[model samples]
Target: MRDSAAGVLLGLACGDALGRPVEFQQTASIQRRHGRVTEMLANGAHGQPAGTITDDTKMALCIAQSLVESGSFDPDDVAGRFVEWYQSGPFDIGILTSTILRRLRNGDAWDEAGIDEWKHLPEGSNAGNGSVMRCAPYGIAFAGEPDALVTASRVSSAITHADPRCQWGCVILNATLAGLLAGEKQPLTSALELAADAPAELRTACEAVLSIMEGSESATDLELANSGYVVTTLQAGLYHGLTAESVEDAIVEAVMLGGDTDTIAAVAGAVAGARFGASELPDRWLRAIDETAEIRELGQQLDTMEISFPESIVEKLSSGQFDLQA
Candidate 1:
């Protein structure tokens, strides 16, 4: 479990750092330039040093560290942490996340802030991968506690995305990760089933993976849209993450598709990481991410966290007037 948790964070960071340089490049251009993109390279999209992770890994580290220190899903504390990180001036932050975090810093309650920000945006543009990209940490912390994991996943996403698709996207994604950590045979579908009220679109989206794993659906059979939309990113990431034979293959394949490569690969990396465990991750990739050590320590902390669904967490979930999953 510890290794699996570590693998989740490590794989996320590895993917973020590796795909950072070539984020929006065309697949043809990526292939022509770097071929498989096995090694980290400098100066492409963000122009950072090689091995530098972007917002995907950085924001996830915030969640993982916040969980370890608080030992519970405290949204306010997490919000404060996010605001602090935002104030630190990150190199990259999703537009929705930035607007919401700015609101949080300006004294809006965590629950109200993101929803309010989400309300001002157009429909399709509102649900984004920002929350889902950094949400895998909840899977480890709440591994065996499915309800707690679900609540955390949705609420954490509600910190920046209020769309049902966006919130449930995090739920199914983390639920799947939690299932994998617990050794569920049919992790993805099983997790979605656990959420009896999961959106049909998300359920249908995630269910596509079963056919994918069963050899009935080929990569060509599926239209893998590598976009910032929460659903598509989660779908593409899961398809690559579950189908790939290895952790390296999962991340590389997702990145090779181009267009939001870092985020797509980061999501894939987390899923593959959970399946393969930390020890299976390449050391070269691990050493490249600056957050690797902290993530490793946080993974160990999460592995040892007592399995308790505190009433406080439960109350927080039910306290909000807006039904996040609805």
Candidate 2:
């Protein structure tokens, strides 16, 4: 459990740093400049400093902190944390998210803040990967219980993202975390199957992602899976999860896939970290990350939290009670 949590934190930081340099680059541009971007660089395509994490890592840590504080999923408290983090100001925040969070901080009711339509913005226009990037903690916090993982994921995601795709992405990520914590080694196909019995909304999304995964080849899988929301980003991460042989490979593949690279890598990193543990993380990468102590502390706190599910559930999952549906 400690290793899993540590892997989660370390994986998050590593992905953040790795993708920070190339967050907005196109596939061709990235290939031209970095040639597959296998190693972490000090600056991205736009020359952003190395180790710079975008809103994805910032929001993810906020979720982790909230989990440590509450010992369970609490959307209200998580929302409050999001508001505070935004007020404190970070280097990067999606425009839609920034607008919504600002309204939340300025006394708008959490439910109503983001619902109003802006000038050119549609009422429910968000299809970003914001939700999936920060969703790793939900999986780690509610490790074994399928129902709880789904519930927490939905609630956590709905704070900023309301699209079905976003919600589905959270479900897939949570299930991947569950499978890894349970010590399963099968590809994401088995993980999605374990989660197929989730609520109807999430089940459909999982099935969509599964179909995409089944027909995709290694080179074009990332292109097939959009990364704008929970579903697509989760699908992209799962593709990497299926093909990657190491934590490093998983993150690199996620980032190289292009389009929301940081977030895809972040989600993939969390899953790979859980499966491989902190020991599997490359030592040089670990040493180069910023905020190593804070990340480590957060992981330790999460590790100390009591497991919320029953022992039977944990054992059933750990023993591979579910069959692979793919």
Candidate 3:
């Protein structure tokens, strides 16, 4: 369990670092400049170091630490942690999320933070990959209970993103985590089919992903997948589910995919790490991440908190037989 959580955190950070350099660049541009971006780079738009992580990894650790500390999903605490985290200014955060979190800090009710209405911002204001990026922890924390996973994902995402697409993206990630933790090796198509009964908005996004992935022959076939919350999250989960032969392979494949690379890698790494555990992660790669001890401590806390769930559930989760529908 400790190793699994460590793998999840380390995978997320490594992916973020690997993807940071080519974040918004086209694949051709990235290939032209960096030649595959297998190693971490720094000082792009943010002027950070080689192994520095972005909001994707930062927010994921925040969520993991919050859940580990509280032992359950607490939106208010999560919001508080997010605000405090941003105030410290670790990475680039999205405008909508920053605005919503600021409002929450100023005493806005959780629901009033523009959770249910698209009109909360402009027409296209709601659907970034921010929510989906940090959502992997929810999947890890609620590995056995689909309802709890979906509900906690909704709660965590609603603090910033209100679009059904964003929320549903979280659901897919959580479902992926559940399946991965359960040791189920269903194809991406079959796994998504299990979520066919999800909300209409989510189903639509999943259908779009299905179309892109159905006939894919090469890695580039995934380029058709969008970087937005809906498409990117599903693509990340699918790629993580399909391509990963090891933890390092998962992180590398996710980072190399290009669009929304950091978030995609982070989300994919989370699921893959959970499925494979820390021992499967390369020692050199794990040693390369920034703040390894902090992330590992957070992982320990998360593991300790698993005691809140029933013992049988925890055992099944550790054994990779936890039921997703449960």
Candidate 4:
């Protein structure tokens, strides 16, 4: 359990670092340029060092830190951390996340900013993987508490991504991560069961992944959607992470899928890491990331620490009282 928990964060950093150089490049371009992006390279997308991570891993670290520090999912604390990071001006923040964080920085309440921004945006323009990319920590902290995990995951996403897809996307992904950390026989399927009330499109995407995994469909036949859309990102990440035979293959394949490579791979890496354990992550990739040590430490902290949720939140979760309106 400890190794799997540690693996989740380590894998997230490795994927972010590995994919940092090739973000936004198409699969063919990635293929033409580097054959398969199995190693970390510098000065590509964000012009950083080879092992540097972008907003994907950075925001994840923020959430992990908040969770570990508060001993539970504290919305105000997580949003405050995000505001601090936003003020630092990360090189690669998603548009929706940037806007919401900007609002949060300008004194917008943590619960109101994302909801307002999401309400004003059109359907297609809303819902990014920004929240999902950093949501793996909840899987560790709430691994044993299904109802609390679902509520916390959704609420955490609502801090920056209020769209139903985004909220439920986080729920599904974290549920799957929790299941993986628990060594479930069919984690994704179990995750789907937990997310039965998720949006139809999101549930459909998950079902498709299940079909492919069950040998009822071929992944090659379907066009891999690596867009910023939450559903597509979740699908791509889950498919590669679950199907790939190794952690290296999972991250590599996710990166090679083109567009939103870093996020896709981060999501995939978390899953693969949980499946294989952080000890199995490529030593070369791990060494390149400067935050590797901190990530490992946080993972260990989250795994070993006794997670404590507030009594009010516990009662709310137990009563199925999910009020997203803030």
TM-score of each: 0.96, 0.82, 0.82, 0.96
- Residue 105, candidate 2: Cα error in Å is 0.9
Query: Candidate 4, which segments miss by more than 4 Å at Cα?
Result: 314-322
Q: Candidate 3's residue-wise lDDT over 120-197, tens digit each?
A: 556455677788888877766776776667667765676787666676677787777667656665434544554565
Model 4 residue 293 CA deviation (Å) reads: 0.8
Q: What is the lDDT of residue 127 in candidate 1?
A: 86
**For residues 1-326, could you state the per-residue lDDT of candidate 4 as single tens digits?**
88999999999888888988999999999999999888899899989988999998999899899989988778889999999999997899999998899888889888678877888998788888999999998888888888878888888898889888988998888889899988896899989999988999999998898898898998776567988999999999998888899999999999998999999999999999999999999999988988888999999898888777667765654575545642
For every candidate structure, what is the RMSD over all alpha carbons to the true structure, in angstroms?
Answer: 1.5, 7.0, 6.5, 1.9
Ranking by lDDT: 4, 1, 2, 3
Candidate 3: which pairs clash?
Answer: 3-278
Q: Candidate 3 lDDT (Cα, whole model)?
A: 0.68
Record all residue pairs in model 2 with backbone atoms less than 3 Å apart, i.e. clashing.
Answer: 21-44, 42-50, 128-228, 129-228, 166-230, 169-230
Once fitted onto the true fold, the runs of candidate 2 whose alpha carbons sit more than 4 angstroms away are 45-47, 114-124, 187-229, 307-326
Global lDDT scores for all candidate models:
0.85, 0.70, 0.68, 0.89
Clashes of 3: 1
The C-alpha local distance difference test score for the whole of candidate 1 amounts to: 0.85
Give the lDDT of residue 226 in candidate 2.
36
lDDT of 3 at 247: 71
